[model samples]
Target: MVETTSHTATVRLPGSKSVTARALFLAALADGTSRLITPLEAADTVAFADGLSTLGFPVDRGGDVWSITGNPTGPPAETAVVWCHDSGTAARFLPALVSLGAGDFVIDASEQMRARPMGPLLRALGSLGVRVHAANGDRIPLRIDADGVEGGVVQVDAGASSQYLSALCLMAPGTRNGLTIEVLDEVSVPYVELTLAMMREFGVTATRQGSRITIGPGTYQARDYVIEPDASTASYFFAAAAVTGNTVTVLGLGRNSRQGDLRFATEVLSAMGCEVTVDDDRTTVTGPTHLRSPGEVVMRDISDTMMTLAAIAPYADGPVRITDVGNCRIKESDRIDAMASALDACGITVHTGADWLEITPGRPHSALVQTRADHRIAMSMSVLGIRTAGIRFDDADCVGKTFPGFHQELAGLQEAWQRG
Candidate 1:
């Protein structure tokens, strides 16, 4: 980790992982050729594209711009297995995509991914007339025997992850009868909105009426799409500024960003006493001399940045309490538990509940951070490493899951901060 006290920095991050994954899926299902400009090239997204290729979707992943020839009918393969690695999006979203084909598709995943929840999505698929056979029940390594999805009314419990509803929504256009989804419980609702927005960009329309959302029978029209910078990843640099009382500007994400996580800059950072300025294409955060706590905040929609706040909380003027993020338990790791453990290891006073984390302000000491093979954990801890000495990560390499060059960029920032 790059340890430093200076915090003035400017960062240009990669495309949004959520948007890139959704674009890959949508591009694969479009009726013609689709071009993804500056798409994210990382482990999880590569797995998604590779899985698409395995299912017979022609994906040309050359350079930053990827071209995909969409097949609206479905995957060309009659039988195939998609190894999703640790990508929850692929593990959850691809099964629904493959269900639109007349084949037996097995969606497999890494050991960690297999432990995450999939029941809600599987049950919804089953309700839509797709046969799901899972030996372990509700988990991956499951086979979906599909003639085609004759999508109709189905109910889904999206309390664990909104990807369940987003997955079904992404594939709804290709179904014969369209889809009427009744969401029983929803968390991270903003992600589903992103999916719907992208669907509309590709020329498909959907409507939401309270808990019910409807998508009529149609197919996506292939078009060139440009992905925005990742807001969740930018939170780390924003936190760096807050921790060290300096300024940081992240380019390519501002008022026009479709990602809900952008609230971390416009809302969370501002609430923490950082002067946040959001222009059309960039956001600048000037940290307060003494960071203030944004007490008792609910992170259900922007939970991905929960660790970013937790990392900088020890420097706050008061205790920082984040709540309503119970869904973090089923992420790449038990994110809530992981944050609690990492914060505790840093010799900071902390408390955790089923859906909340509270960190009391105290002088933090150096400790080895355990990343639990999660990208978010690694990146968030790196933010703390900026102000604390001896803050090392056990598995820093896991950051390759999303931002492959995170360490290098952070190191560059450290050097730039020191030079000035």
Candidate 2:
């Protein structure tokens, strides 16, 4: 049994991998050398680096520093096979960018990656005169044959994943002509905003009017950029203080973040009876006397933090319901089932459906959780394990997929036994 105790701790989160990868890709397409500070060095970012390298982008790394030479005129290389592993952002974004090259290029990944839907993206690309083939339905291991993108009007379903829309937008400027994207049933709209905001920082403009976005054919101007702290990773530490009745402050993230998951701190503090103060560069969360369950929270905007919500659910006084998150079913794993199953194993009754999860707090029970090789699952289970008596996580090393220092960060909060 690995015994752990709850304690007060303040932690600083790494830069957002989501933002870093997009910024890196844009920088690679810029006109000159781009400098990115506080960038995440996780597997996903590494995969993005590999994809750029395969396409002839010059990338140099030293310690926590990174430099990318822009290839605004396009790469000198031809089509080649690029593997994105299970990184959806890499898989989705790379395909559109590769369309700028000539020849047949294939993007492949793990079995789980192959299961994630890519039909919406494929259909949208096809509408823009790009040919794509999915070895298994509309999933990964996608093959793309591109001479170049013929820009025109394209319609896409934004309900599935915002990455699809963002990918198209990123590739729009490199097309033969400008492109206009009409979205149908948009969800997780904040992520799209983040993408557009980053594009503007790189000298590309994407105008979002209602559900439609128009991108003009232009070159990306390379410039020095600094990635902001990851809001998703910040949620775990914030939740720690909220659940354990302690004071914890997360540095490098604040009110003016382009990342939408930053809003999670406000929602969590509001629900768990904590006082939240957001300043220019930091956010402090102070726990209350007792945490109360805010039953039925609509989490459409903050869907990425659903796992953190599940981790804190066991501490709530009553049933905690999470809704408007059907998109969770299509992430790195089927988060809906994975969360309910993990919580159920811990002696909690979880009422779950296609799009909602209802968790009732009860006595903590020890159980080994299967993380399904998902980074968020592994992180969430580890956080919950802090409050449990005997907890073991299978594939705990899967945290390297995103946050490589996750275990070390958890160790800072409390003592945990590591088994070989």
Candidate 3:
């Protein structure tokens, strides 16, 4: 086994991809130039910037900050090509921005993203009067002809993906008729709230009343914003500590941060027997030498960490039950199935249910992991590989979607432990 020696180290992460993507969209749609400080410079966020640039938003990066010029009047290109690649944020959010533009836009993605769900968001855009043309049902390589979004009441079941609702909400302020989004069923509700909170910072108002969100026929005002550290990415390092019996400290993810994934440290890791201490400056995770099961975990809101916890499941002393994470099936990959398959490859017994997974611990054998072109899968599986040998990745580069230096971070972990 390639178990890491117990060590103490504080790691500083790049800015939040979720916040950076939304900020880029809002800044691109605003009237004034907005300065994004310490934004995430990763593949997915870069795809967002590239797509926005294609839509005529000039993004300039110098040092850690990004200066993006907003194009309030829409893209100059009448017919635009927007590439979302493997980013769910770009796939879902960018289409709504196109609907607010006076142009014909075509969006495409990698094979991984093509398999994810987007029909609900597309149909919602169609309800706003944008002509959507999807090839072979509602997949990417689709065309959108938009004079502009004339929003009224748009309904979407965000249960499959909260990005579906965020896609509609981001461009609602720019719509002529405003918008009232009816959430048929919601998952990752905190992410939607984060989007709204960022929207308010950009000078747009989104009032959430129960499942319906009312937004005005308004516009975003560009402002200087600082992106918080990535909480989703933080889960991996936290998992590193948990699996290796080390102390991992993450800097910049303060307690007041908006990224909902931070709760994974508190709810999941701590519940799994790690000692978690959060403060305004940083969060520290001290792993127990012997891992324990936290019983059944319901990961409805903090489902992004589903795979992270899955990576740690093999190390558990007893069976660990995970529930309320059915929506994970539609993420970058079928995470439930991916976890099942990966765990099975490592000799762990995994029982899959419609909305739950029960992972029974065993002496894990090293196995080649398949990432399915999913960032979370790559990262999570990497964590599992740390404490076990023969942990090879089929597509290790997929972590570039969020954490470009993830492998380097793993290397740094080794250095810290060695130094200790």
Candidate 4:
């Protein structure tokens, strides 16, 4: 079992995996080369590498360097089916690229991915003249025959996953007639903005008018792009500071980040009575005597930070109610259930519903946390472990799926405690 202790420390998070994946997909369609800095080297990114390789794009990954040579002309023949594993980004983004191919390609995933919904994206693809068939009725192992795409006006339900809308927008400019996307009840609007920002960086412009988005026919121009630090991952350190009454500085991020999760720093730190300052590329958070739990918070935009918030609940003075997070149910793990189970095991009072989590602040308890093969679960639980007397985590290796440097960062913080 890995052991950790609470301490005052500063650390930097890796580049946003969500941004890296989207930027790589867009760069692969660009006319030139693109360079990404501090890119996340994890399972999800590896899945994207495999998918891009199958699509005829050359991707090289070593240490912290990721190089991509895009195929602006289009992908080669799909002689084999691509396995996207459990990565929803790969599953959604690659399907749109496959629509430009001349042959049939079948995209399949693990059991967990199959359990996740794909109907919204499939329906939108069908409207764009791509033939898609799902095995077991609207699930994974989707077969795609992409002779050509018409690409006029397409309506997609954005309720389940914003990736569906993102996939369509990224591939819109490549189509013969461009595309217009009408979104119905869209969640995670910030992620959609991230997608549009990345698309524009690659020389494709998209206009968002309320629930509708329009993209014109254009070609992507290859350029060097730097991915910002992951704000979602940074939330853990911010919470650590709040829980331990320490001051922590998170570097390599900004106030103007396209990542929606960046908002979590402001919301969480402010709510916890921390002094926060955001500069061009860093944020500093100073913890107060105790955190004040607002009655309820709408987390639809920053759902990724739910795990981090749950970890800090034990230090709050009152109950923390998280709402508008229905999308969390379909993440790598059912985050709502995973968080509730882990926190409850740690002797925290947790009330859970389909889309909400209400946590009552109390004393920390010793327990073993099961990560459910989810990176966020592992990181959040580890942070909580630092405050508890004795906390063991199952499957600690899950942190490598996103932040490979997590263990090292924890070690540095623990060293500070020992020295003090």
Clashing pairs in 1: none
Which segments of model 3 are wrong by more than 4 Å? 1-6
What C-alpha lDDT values do all the predictions have?
0.90, 0.82, 0.87, 0.81
Question: Compared with the true structure, what per-residue lDDT tens digits does model 2 show for residues 199-258?
Answer: 898897789898789999998888877788788888887777676666677887888887
What tens digits encode model 3's per-residue C-alpha lDDT throughout 1-420?
Answer: 234446799999989989999999899988888999999999889899899888877888776889888876566567799888888889888888887778789999988888776788888888778899987777887798879877799899888888999888888888887899999998888899999999998888889999899999887898899988999999999999998889989999978888889988988888877899999989999888788888888889989999898889878878888899999988888899998998888888999988889998887888888888888888998888877778888889988889889999987986787688
lDDT of 2 at 386: 65
lDDT of 2 at 147: 86
Can you tell me which runs of candidate 2 are displaced by over 4 Å?
Answer: 1-8, 415-420
CA RMSD, predictions in order: 2.0, 3.4, 1.8, 2.8
Please give the range of 10 consecutive residues that has the lowest summed lDDT in model 2: 1-10
Residue pairs with colliding backbones in model 2 are 31-222
What is residue 160's positional error in candidate 3, in angstroms? Answer: 0.5
- Of the candidates shown, which would achieve the greatest TM-score relative to the real structure? 1
| Cα lDDT of model 1 by residue, 239-303, tens digit | 88877777788989989888999898889989988889999989998888778889888999999
lDDT of 4 by residue, 1-420 (tens): 122333455677778889988988887877777776678777788888788887777777765767787766456655558888878888888889888767888898888788887888988898777889987767888998877576899999988788899999988888888898888878888999999988887887799988889998888887777777888888888777776666777888878788888777787668777778888888887777767786688988888898888888877778989998989998889999999999999889899998999999888789888888888998988788767877777888878767877867875765664565
lDDT of 1: 0.90
